[model samples]
Target: IKDHLKHHQTQTTCWDHPRMAELYQSLADLNNVRFSAYRTAMKLRRLQKALCLDLLSMQAACELFEQQALKQNEQLLDVPQLLSCLSGLYQRLEQSHAHLVNVPLCVDMCLNWLLNVYDTGRSGKIRTLSFKTGIVSLCKAHLEDKYRFLFRQVASATGFCDQRRLGLLLHDSIQIPRQLGEVASFGGSNIEPSVRSCFQFANNKPELDAAMFLDWMRLEPQSMVWLPVLHRVAAAETAKHQAKCNICKECPIIGFRYRSLKHFNYDICQSCFFSGRVAKGHKMQYPMVEYCTPTTSGEDVRDFAKVLKNKFRTKRYFAKHPRMGYLPVQTILEGDNMET
Candidate 1:
C-alpha cells in the first residue's frame, strides 16, 4: 500500500496507469456506442475538460506565442521561455475552467504534453513549427480547417507534402491521443503505418497535394480520429435541447441530446447516456438518434416514423445486427500486424 501510494504520487498525468488506457477506450466506445462521431467527440471533450487537459484555443495560443517575434518555422523556444508562455496560457484557462485552480499542476501537465508531443528528445527546446503544429492540432477548430492548417505547416511552397513531411504531421497528430492516454486505442505512437497508409491512399505518389490529403482525411484514419471528434464536440458545445432526460430528469438537455427511436418522447441527457443509465423498459440495444442541435418539425416527424418502424424489430434482430457508428479505415500494415 505504501509503495502504491508512492507510485501514484510520482505519476505526472492522470492516465499514467496501465488501466487508464482501457478506461479511456471504454468511455469512448460507450459514448460512441451507436457510432456517431459527434457523440464520441462530445464525450472526449467532456473528458478532456474533466481532466483539465484542454489547452488554450488556437486564437489564444497564437496571440500568446506570436508576440515573441520569433522567425517562422525556424526559431526555437527553450524550456524557460516555453514555461513562461504556458504560464500565460494557464492564466487564461483559469478564467474558464474552474478545475484548473491548481496553477502549478495544470501548467506542468500542459508543459508535459507540449514537450512529449513536440520535443520528443527532451532537448528542452522546441521548433516554432512543431510548437504551432501541436497547438493547432489540439485547438478548437473545424477538423478540415485544422487539417489544412497542419498540412500548410508541413507542405512545400507548391502546397504538396512528400513522405517525410506527411510523416512529421502524423507524428505530431498522434501525440494528442498519446498525451491523453488513449494512444493504444489509436494504434500506438508509431506514425509510420499512418504515413504509409496516406501515401498508399494517394496511389503511392511521390508527393500529395492538399486535395489528396483531404481525401485520405475523410476516411478517418485511426490515429487522427480524435480531430474530427473534437470538431463535433465544439459544434455542440453550446447546444441545448428543449427536453428532459427520462432517467435523470434534467431539463433542457445540454450538449448532445439522445432521443430514443423505439419510445415516444423518450430523451436522454448527455450525462445519463454516457453513464449507461436507462429508464424502465429501454434497452441499451435500442436504436436512437443523436442531435447536437435542436430538432426541427420535419426532423421530428422523420424520427417518429423511424421509431415506429423500429418498434416492429425484435430484440434478437437488434442483437444479431449491431450498427457501426463510424467507418474507420484499416491500413495494410494494420492487417499484417494482427495481434491475434
Candidate 2:
C-alpha cells in the first residue's frame, strides 16, 4: 500500500512539490495514504469515500464498544488493575481497527455502522484541512468563514517558527488560483470556478482558508520543538554561529500586515526597500534607523526598538502637518534584504 501511494505521488502527480508541503504534512501525519486505490481512478475515489465513511462508522463503533465494555466492567478494579485494563483495551482497539476491513462482509458491515458516528465531523474537517495544504486550493475551493476563524486561531496559538513558516507558505500558495485564473478564462473548466470564487479576496491575495495553513504548522512537531531560543543556544556551543540582526524583529506596525520571512532589524542591502523618506501623502515622519547598535537581550522587547521609534517618531509627527501641500512619508522596514 505504501509503495502504491509513493508511486502515485511520484509518477502520477507532482505530490512532492514544495508548494504542496502542507498537504504532504497532512498525508504523512495521518498515515492516510491509500495504495491499492491507485490501480484505478474509480477504485481510488471509492477508497477515499470508504475511508471517510469509515471515519463516521468508527464513532458508532466506539460507542457500542464502550457500552459492551461497560457491562463487562461493572465491577470496578483497584487503580493498578484499572490502569492495566485500560492499556490492554487501547491496544486491542488499535489492533481490531487495523484488521476491521479485512474481516468478512457480515462483520465489516456491523463495524462500519458503528464507526460512522465518529467519522461525522472528521470528513469535513479533514477535507478542509487537506485543501488548506494545497496552496491556492483552499482559496480556490471557496472555504466558508468558519474555517477562516479556525485557521486564525490555530495560527495564533501555534509556536513562532512554525507559525512563521506557515505564513510564508500561505502567502506563496495565494498565487495558485491566480496563475490558473487566466487559463480558467479560456472557457474550459473553471479552475477558479464560481463555487470556489467565494474563497478569494476581490483585491487579490489568497486569504480564503488559512486554516489549513494554520493547522499544518501547528501539527508539525517542528513548529514548537527546537525553538529559536534553544536553537541559538545549541548553535553557540557548536561554533557555527548564526548571524544576528541589528534591529529588533518583534515589533508590530499599525495598519500593516506582518512580513517576517526576511530580516527586519537593521538589515542592510544594496536592493533598498525604502524610498529614503516617509510614504507620499502620509502623515508621519519616517524614522532613520541606525543599525550599528548593540544586540538586545530580548528581555523587554517593548523597549528594544525604542531607539529607532524615538528617532523616527518626530519625523512622523512632522509629516502630519507639513509646511508644504502634501505629506511626505519616510520608508519603514520595507526593504528586501537588510540584515547584515
Candidate 3:
C-alpha cells in the first residue's frame, strides 16, 4: 500500500495540471510533462465521486457509533477523542455500505475523517501539533494491525508530520477532492479558532529555539508561547541580525509598539499604530508602546518616511474625513465662545 501511494503521487494525471502549474510556479520551477486532458478529467470525475462516497460512509459510521455509545451511557473524552473513534467505525461501514464500490484504504478514510474534523470552522492545512496529536490519539485506541502500520508510517515521536509528508503518505491510496485545493488556499492565517487559544502574547521578544517549539506543543497551561515574539526573534536572526518593524519591515528609529496582551514582540513603528494601521491579527484597539528610547518624548517622534508610509498603508483612515470645503462656518452669534 505504501509503495502504491508513492507511485500514485509521482503519476501524472490530467486534473493535476492546473494545481501542478501553480505549485511549480510558486517554487519557480516547471516541467514539460504532458497528459491526455479528456482521460484525466474522466479519471478525476470518478475519483471525486469515490471521495464523496467515502466521506458519506464515514459520516454515517460516526453517527451510528455516537448513537450506540450514547445508548450505553458512555461519555466521550473530547472532539479529538470522538474523531479518533473513526478507526473502529470504518470496519462496520465496509461491511454494510455495498454501494461504496470503491472503498478507500481504512487508514486513509479514517485520517481523512480526522482531517475534516480538525479543519472545521477554520481554513488552511492542520498545523503540526494538532496533526500529530490526532494521529497518536487514534493509534492509542487500538486499531487493527494493517491500520496501525499505516498510521505509524505517517507519525513520528520526534515531531509533527507536515502536509507534504501526509500528501506522500496517502497520495496514491485515495484521491484528494478539489475542495481540498480551496481549503489549502485559505492559508495559515485562517488557523482553527480553538487552536488559537493555545498561545498568549508577550510584552517583549520571545526565545523560540527548537526546545521552545516542542514545549509549546505540549499544551501546558503555564507555558507561555508568544508567536509574534518568536517571529521577531526569527526575523532578526535571518535578516542580517536586524529586527524590522512588524508593520513596516524597515529600521525603527523611534522603535516599535504593540497594544495587545495577546501579542508579544510584535513591534510596529509609532506612525503605523497611531495612524490606525491594521493587519490580519493586529487591530487598532490594541495599545502601542515604544522601545529602546531614553526619554518618553522620543517615543512620540514621527519620522517623515514613517508618517508617509502610514498614510498610504492606512488609506481607509483618510477616507473617513469630509472634504475641507465642507467645513461648517462659525457664527459669532452662536452661544458657544469662539477665539479669534
Candidate 4:
C-alpha cells in the first residue's frame, strides 16, 4: 500500500501527461466555440458594412457559385443538374432584371471570344498571350462599361487580374440578395440571421478601418449596377491622363516618349534613357517608338542603328531587314529630369 502511494505520487497526473493533452485542447476548443462563432459574425458584419453587402447572403451565394463552378468543370453535370443550375442562376439574376438581360449576352460574347482565341486546333487551355489579346479584343468590342473596366483591370499596367481575382471581384461586387437564403441553406445553418445578430450586438459601434477598406476597394474594379454611369466618368478620367513611360514613369505632357513592343505595358522616356535613369527590366535593345508623336527620320536610320548597337550592346537586337544596307530609326531629344 505504501509502495502504491509512492508510485502514485511519482506518476504524472492526466492533466500533466502529454498523452492526455489532446483532451484538454478539445475541451478548451469546445468552451470557445461560441466565442469563435461570435468573432466570425463580427468579422462578417465588418465586411458587410465595408462592402455594403449582406455577408450571410454573400457567403451563401459564394458557396453555391463555387459548387456549381466545380460541378460544371468536373463533367459531373447531368441534364437535370444542368437545368437546375441554370434555373437557379436565372432566378438569382432576375432580382436585378437589368443585369439579367445583359449577363447572358456578356457570357456568350466571352465564350465566343475564348473559342476564337483557341482556333488554331490547339489545346482548349488559353496561352498567356492569347488571354491578354483576347481581353483587349473583348474590351474593344463590348460597349458595356462593366466589361471595359474588367478587361482594363487585366490589360492595363495596373497588373494581371487572373481567374481567382476575377471570381472574387465578381462575387463581392454582384448582388444576388434574393438568392442569399437559399444559398445559406446550402452552406448550412451557421450563417443564419439570428446568429449574425448576436455577432453585431457584440461590437455595436461604428469602427471604420480605412486601410482594410482601401485594400478591398483596390480589388473591386467597379460596381455592376452603376457601370453605365461609371463608364462615362472613367473614360473622361482616362482621357485626362496620358500613358506614362514604363522606365521613367513620366507622361508625354511636355514631349514625345517611346513604348516597348516586347511588353504591352512598358514605355520609356528619352530623359530617363539619356540620363541613365532607365528602370531595370526595360531592355534598351527592345524597340521603342514615339506613341503620340513622330520621332522617326529616314536620314537617321544608319546612325540610329549604330547608336542603338553601342548603347544597348549588352542586349541583342536583330535587324528585321538584315540584307538592307541600313534600317530606319527614330531620333528623340532628351527631356528635363525635373519634368519627369
Highest lDDT: which candidate?
1
Model 1 poorest ten-residue lDDT run: 331-340
Candidate 2 per-residue lDDT over residues 211-273, each given as its tens digit:
443343232111111111122222222231123322233222211111122122333210121
Worst 10 residues of 4 by lDDT: 331-340
lDDT of 3: 0.33
Which of the two candidates, 3 or 4, achieves a greater lDDT against the reference?
3
Best by TM-score: 1
Measured against the true structure, the TM-scores of the candidates, in listed sequence, are 0.66, 0.18, 0.21, 0.22
Q: What TM-score does candidate 3 reach? A: 0.21
Point out where model 3 deviates above 4 Å: 1-48, 51-62, 65-84, 99-104, 112-188, 191-340
Candidate 1: deviation at residue 177, Å?
Answer: 2.1
TM-score of 4: 0.22
Per-residue alpha-carbon lDDT of model 3 for 144-186, expressed as tens digits?
2323333334444544434343333333122122222212211
Candidate 4: clashing pairs of residues? 246-267
| Model 2 ranges with Cα > 4 A deviation | 9-150, 158-173, 179-340
Residue 261's lDDT in candidate 2: 20
What's the distance in Å from true for residue 288, model 4? 5.1
Clash pairs for candidate 1: 35-325
